[model samples]
Target: MTLLQDPANKNRYKVNLVPAANGLNVRTQIPFYSPWRVFFFADNAADLAETMLLYNLNEPCKIENTEWIKPVNYVGIWWEMHLGISTWAMTERHGATTENMKAYIDFAANHGIDAVLAEGWNKGWENWGEKDAFSFTEAYPDFKLKELAEYADEKGVMIIGHHETGGDIELYERQLDSAFALYQSLGIHHVKTGYAGPTPDGEHKHGQFMVNHYNLVMQKAAEYEISLDVHEPVMFSGLCRTYPNLMTGEGVRGMEWNAWSEGNMPSHTCIIPFTRGMAGPIDYTPGIFDIDLSAHKEDREKWNSEDRGNTAVHATLANQLALMVVLYSPMQMAADLIENYEGHEAFSFIENMPATWDESIYLDAEIGEYIVVARRSGTTWYVAAITNEEKRDIAFIANFLNEGKTYIARMLYDSPESHYENNPEDYQILETEAQQLDGFNLKLAPGGGAIIVFEPD
Candidate 1:
C-alpha cells in the first residue's frame, strides 16, 4: 500500500491560518487511504467541523468540511440522468446491444475521470408508483456484476454502484444479508442508495431516517469494507468525518431536473451554492458541459422537455471544471453524456481534475451571483471562478500559489475575438507562468465562466 506523508512524514498535507472578521479560517489537512487523495477542512481546529478518515473503500468520497463555507472541493461525474435508466438504455436508443456498455466504460477510462456513477441500473424505479423502487441485481440481467467490477478494475476506473430501495427500510434491513452478499461477491465497493417519497402510513422511520439510514449502512459497510453514495433522504451533517466511505448524497433538483421540468430554471444552478449546498456536501453533480438547448431525443420527453436556452456553453464548461473546487463531492459526478465531451478541448480540463484534495481555500464570492474557489491535491492546484447570468470582466489575483514557486497556468475563458458565444468547447486555452503577485482579467459572456489549473514549476 502507498501511504502518504508530508515532507516531515506527519501524513499532513497542509495547515493554513486565514484571519476573518468574526474569527479565523483555520484549516489543517491530512491524507486518506483510498483512491482519491482527500484532505478534510474545518473552522475550529478540526473539532467544530468534522474530519473524514478513510480506512477502506466502502462509501463514496466525502466533503469532510462545509460549514459556513459555501464553496467546497470535489471533482467527479455521473453516467445516468437519474435513477431512471441504464447504459443499456442509451444503446437501446440506437437499437444497439448492451455490449456497448464497454464503449461507455472505455470513454470514461480514456478521460481523466475519478469515477463513473451509473444511476437507474437498479430494479426499483419501474414500480415506484407501487412503492417498490428499484433493484440492482434483477434489473440488468446482462450486467454481470462480477465482470463489470473486473472490467472497471482493469481499466483503472472505480464503479459507483446504485441501489434504490424506494424507502422500504424494513425490506432493506431484512434482506441486508443478501444485498451485502451480492456486493461482496462482485467486489463492488461503492453504492448510491436512495429513499424518496413519504413513509408508510405516516409511521416514519427515524427523525433523521436519511442520515440514520446512512449511518446504519456505514456500519454494515464497514463490516464488508464498502463505500456509500446516498440520495434524496438525509441532509449532510458531517458524518463523512466519522464514516469516510460516505462520499456524497443528493438533496436537490440537479441537472436531471433541467431535462424534465420547467421549474428547474437555468438560474437554479447558480442558486444552489447558497441554499441547499450550504447544509453540507451535496451530490449536486454539476458539469453539463453541453447546453445544446436545442438537441432532441426520445429520452428528452421522458425528462419533461423543458426549455434550456443557450446559456453560454463556455459558462457550462467553466462550471463543470470549476465544480472540482466550487462544489463539494469527494466522489463528485461530471454529470454529462459521453458524446457531449467528444472533441471538446475543455474536456481536457475535466479529465485533469482530481476528485479528492489535499488542501482547499474558498478564495471569495457573493452568494448566487459568483464565486471563486481554489483546491490543491499535492503539488498541483486548481481554481474555478464562475458567474451567474451576467457577463463579467473580472481580475483574479494569483494569491493562492506559492511565492517564488514558478507554476504553469492552463486557463479557458471567453474572449472578444471569438465568434462563438459561451461556447466552452471552443474557447482558447492558454498557458502562462506565475512567480509573483500576478493577475489576469477574465472576460466572461452572459452565462460564461473561467477554469484554470496550476502545476508546480
Candidate 2:
C-alpha cells in the first residue's frame, strides 16, 4: 500500500495498492470480498489506546484450550550481536553457543524471567540474507539445541526458539511443520521468527501474498501449540484475538535500529502508543541498560561495518526502564547483555515487571510529545511516562490505585543532571508512601522518562 500526496492540492492524498502481478493476488470465483478498511475515532490518546475496534472486527478464538498460550518475560543472546560484542555467525565470539545459551537461561531463571531466546543456535547465520541458506531444524556445530532445551527446562525456564528464514518464505513454508515440531518436541512453546531479506517473488511484506503466508504460519504454529513472535512482519491487526498464539510482532521500528543507525528519536516511543500500539501487542524489546556502545566500540568497528560508533540508544537509561511498562507486549525482552544487567540496581525493575497485565489505564498523553500510562497486575500497579526531546514537568495522580488503600510507590526517574545525548545513564530511584488519590510532580529531563511501581502498603 502506497500513499501519495497531491502535488497541486496540499490537503489531498491518494491511497493505492500495488499489484502483485503474481496471479495469486485475487482469484475468487463468485462475489469477491475484500478485507475490512477500518477508521478509528478517538477524543483523546487514552481513548485511542483503549480502542478495541481491530479485535472486534476479527473473528473469535479458533484454537480451543489455549492453556499453552502464555505470556513470557525473556532474555536472549540477541542484543550482544547487535552491539558487535558477539557475532551471529559461528565464530570465536559466536553468541548462541550452548554455553552462552545455558548462561542466558541461568540469568533468566535467576532473575524470574520466563524464557531465553537463542537467535544464532540454528544453522544459517553464516549465510544470512541468502534464500534457502537456512535449515530451520538444524543446529549449529557449537549449539546443542536439545541439550540446551533440556537444561533450560531443568532450570525452570523455557527456550524461545528462533527461525531466521532470510525472507525466503518458500523455504520457511516448506520447513514450518518440521521446525515447529522440533521445538514442540523439545518442550519449547515460544518461537521468534524473522524474515530479514527480500521475498523470493518480489513480494512486499504487507502484500496479499505475504499476508496469507503470515496467516498460514500462525495457523500452522497452533497445530504444534507454539506461540509466535514475528519480526519483519506485516502490521498486526488484532489477530491475537482469533489466534491467541499470535503473541507479539515486530512490525514497527524497534530497538535494533538503535545499534546500527541514528536510532529512534525520543518522541518515537512517545507516539507509538497512540498509533502502532492501537493495532495490537508490539515486541519493542525494551530494557537496555547500556545506553551508549562505549564498551563495544572497538568490537563493533571490527565486526560490523554498519555500526559507525556515533549511534546510541538516544534515550536516558530511565527511559529504557520505563518502556517495559509503556509498551505492551506479551513476550517482552530484557534486551541487553546479561553482563550489562548483572548486579545493576535498576535491573530490579525489569526483574519484577510483569509481561501480562490484568488491567491498563492510559492516564494522559499528547501525541509525539509525552504519554503516561498505568497497568495493573494482581494488586501492584506499574505506571510509565515518557517525553520527547524537551524537558518537561508532569504530575502523577494515584486516583487509579485501589480505593482507601495505602501504597508504596517506587519511582525510577531521570536525574537532574541527565540528558539523552550527554549523560544518558544518570538516574535516581526514590520510594515514598502514597494514599489513594495522592499525587506527585516529577521532573523529566530532555529525552527522558520515569517508571513507578505501586505496591499496597
Q: Judging by lDDT against the true structure, name the best candidate.
A: 2
Q: Which stretches of candidate 2 lie over 4 Å from their true place?
A: 1-15, 23-25, 302-305
Candidate 2 per-residue lDDT over residues 1-457, each given as its tens digit: 5456899998777765644647454545777777676767888877788778999899999998899998999999998887777888888988899888888888988999899998888787888776678898999899999999889989999889998888888889999989999999999899999988887675777777888899999999999999999998888888999999999998889999898877999999988887788889999998998898775667663455665668899899999988888999999999988888999999999989998999998888899998888899999999898889999898977898878899999999999999999999999999999988898787999999999999999
lDDT of 1: 0.58
TM-score of each: 0.74, 0.96
Model 2: weakest 10-residue lDDT segment is: 18-27
Model 1 ranges with Cα > 4 A deviation: 1-98, 131-133, 203-211, 263-271, 293-299, 303-315, 417-426
Q: In angstroms, give how far residue 17 of model 2 lies from its true place.
A: 2.9
Question: Candidate 1 on 119-166: residue-level lDDT in tens?
Answer: 555454446646444454654554455676688679866666666676
Among all candidates shown, the one with the greatest TM-score: 2
List all candidate RMSDs to the true structure.
Answer: 12.2, 1.7
